[model samples]
Target: MDILAKERKLLELEKQVEALGNNEAVNKLKSEIEKYKHNEMTKLTAWDRVLLARHQKRPTALDFINYMSPDFIELHGDRLYSDDKSIVGGIGSINGVPFTIVAQQKGKDLENNLERNFAMPHPEGYRKALRLMEQAEKFKRPIITIIDTPGAYPGIGAEERGQGHAIAQNLLKMSEFSVPIISVVIGEGGSGGALALGVANKVLMLENAIYSILSPEGYASILWKDASLAPKAAEVMKLTAYDLEEFEIIDGIIKEPLGGAHYDKRETFKRTKQAIITEYNKLRRLSGTELQYRRTSKIRKFGFFQRFNYDNLGGIKR
Candidate 1:
């Protein structure tokens, strides 16, 4: 059975045990359920982590922002276009240290998701994020970006508004920012939408989060002509936190609760807050020049590859 199916079965048993109240059998049943849960969690595959990352109850960017900075005040608009609800930016403080916070905000349900455009940003969203980051640099406050988007919006309106240009501008500006910046991938970090806010001194991802150029289903559809093979595609894509960390693409990984972040949001928030603060403390010691240099240096090192001679294999020579 799948993880959710097993969880449902366990829930049913717990309900039955509750009816029998104060008995040794109930205690024994509870212990078995706990054991089962632990074993299943330990055996999770990459696809399972993907599902967990996209879990409905998983805490969103705003949830983490509010937990880390109770006094967070949201700012709106790209100053040129209307406000894009998909991306949120503002000022907040963590442990008395002020920061400019930017994040992709996903809604809790269908209605809210529609309002947020399913967290798929438009051109204005990236522009708003850039505006906020520029302000952060001017004020000398560290910037924290929470990434959790499948990708940027690809609708006709977004394209007409220059979605690609907006994302590219953010990338160019972020690399030159003279303030400390840290980005965290809390869930699905797909394509340039995520990378637009991801050029940071330190990049981190939750244990279960996935980051890649595209979604596994999209990859499967393009490569194998079958979207149903997403599970297999996930394995080959290596989009998991451990995989990215192994490749040295991500700086660090924050631990999640047993099942997922949604299982224990308070613990998840605590760990995320601690991780961000710890990374920021380290980056805070460096000068603005050093910070920009390190960030750009890190970006330049991506996509390293070795060249081989095709003549040796009886193939066309370069």
Candidate 2:
């Protein structure tokens, strides 16, 4: 029921736009949406955007997987703890090229939410993902990961089971894997939860998807002692896909629909599929060793462009 209000207004907008048929009224709505969205979102704090990333109505990893992948056969269980419903893994074909798809799925509706634990995966969930990753590597299938989670599960039980270690292991495993792996952030990508699956050859983020170390609220709470300053924090943090791309932190940006992914998932999927298809072909040509080096260089380049002052030396030093 949380996203119900947004859904209702969205339907109204849809009907209104359809009847207006690209007329002034439809254009007005578009303008209004852009302004309102920018105004509200720009002011959001890190944690506020985190909430938006986890919005129930926002399209999930499963939605994109179903739209883009062919013959999805989901694999389950961590072989350590009971299967964490948050992460969905399996063998599938991306753009008809055989690939192993792994995605973080946020549940909608009561039953599914309970099943998915609100898209927060436990230690076993990550372990299961690693298992699938190794299996995919064995078959030489390029891995595709769909990221969407507000970080890993923070529950006491999850920590007790070595959650941080599992996430760290995933990052290390992904970095050294010979097979090509591509990750796209379709929705909320917070902290290590996103990074665990994000160490890849190409990292793509949807226009609206955010990738940040901490939510605006969390950052504000810790640094400023007030969560109300989240919007300011969001502005300073550069969590937007555009911002990340500008900094060369992510490889590409997958554009969304006119309004947002929450407004029209079909349009979002269309563009996302194109991005994946493009990357898949491009990376497939490279040798496994070459791919790893490229990936390594890409990640290492982040924040590498820092001050190289050589004023005292009187020459531009390398």
Candidate 3:
């Protein structure tokens, strides 16, 4: 069974055991549940981690912002177009350190999802994020970005507004920013939508999160002409945090609570907060020139590969 299905069955069993009013049975079932969780979490597949990252009850960007910075002041508008609700940018302080926080916000329910376009941002959303980061740079505050998006909106209206240009601008400006930039992948980090805000001195991902150029379904559809083979595609995509860390695509992984972040949100948030702080502490010590150099160097090294000689078998080189 899938992770969600197993979790549902476990919940139902726990409820039934509690309803029986036998303390001994209840205690025994709880212990078994804990054991099950431990075993399952240890062997999660890439697709399993995808499900956990996109869990309905998973903590959203606003949730993390509120928990980490109670006094956050939200800023809106791109100054060039209308404010896009899918992207939320603001100024906040975490542990007394000021930061400009930009996050892609997903709705918790149907209505809210419709309103936020299911976290699929438009060109204006990227512009808004760029504006906030520019402001942060001016004020000499660190910038923190929370990424969780399937991709940028592909609608005609979004394209009419120069969607690609907006994303490109953010990447170029972010690379040159003097202030420290740290990006955390909290969920579905897909396509340029995620990368638009992902140019950072240090990139991190939650243990269960997945970061990829595109979704597994999309990859499967393109390669095999069947979206149903997404699970198989996930195995080949190398999108999991562990895989990305091994590839040096991400700087570190923040451990999630057992089962997923939704299972223990408070603990998850606490760990995420600590990870951000730790990374920031290291970045803060560097000068503006050093920060820029570090960020550009990191970006330049992406997709690097070692050359191999193959002239022994055939006079061909790859």
Give the per-residue lDDT of model 2 (tens digit) for 1-318. 223344466568667767777878678888886565555444534444445566667888888888888588999998877888899999888656888888888887889988898778899999999999999889898999999888898999999999999999998888888898899998888899889999999999987789999887898899899998877787788998878998988999987654457767888889998998899889989998999899888888878777788978898866
Q: What TM-scores do the predictions have?
A: 0.95, 0.84, 0.97
Best by TM-score: 3
> Model 3 over residues 1-318: C-alpha lDDT tens digits?
778887787788778877877688678878897788688677888888988888999999999999999999999999998999999999999999999999999999999999999999999999999999999999999999999999999999999999999999999999999999999999899999999999999999999999999999999999999999998999999999999999899999999988899989999899999999999999999999999999999889989978778898786898
Q: Rank the models by TM-score, top first.
A: 3, 1, 2
Question: Against the hidden true structure, what lDDT does model 1 obtain?
Answer: 0.94
Candidate 3's TM-score: 0.97
In model 3, which regions exceed 4 Å deviation?
311-318
In order, candidate lDDTs are 0.94, 0.83, 0.93
Model 2 scores a C-alpha lDDT of: 0.83
Better of 1 and 2 by lDDT: 1
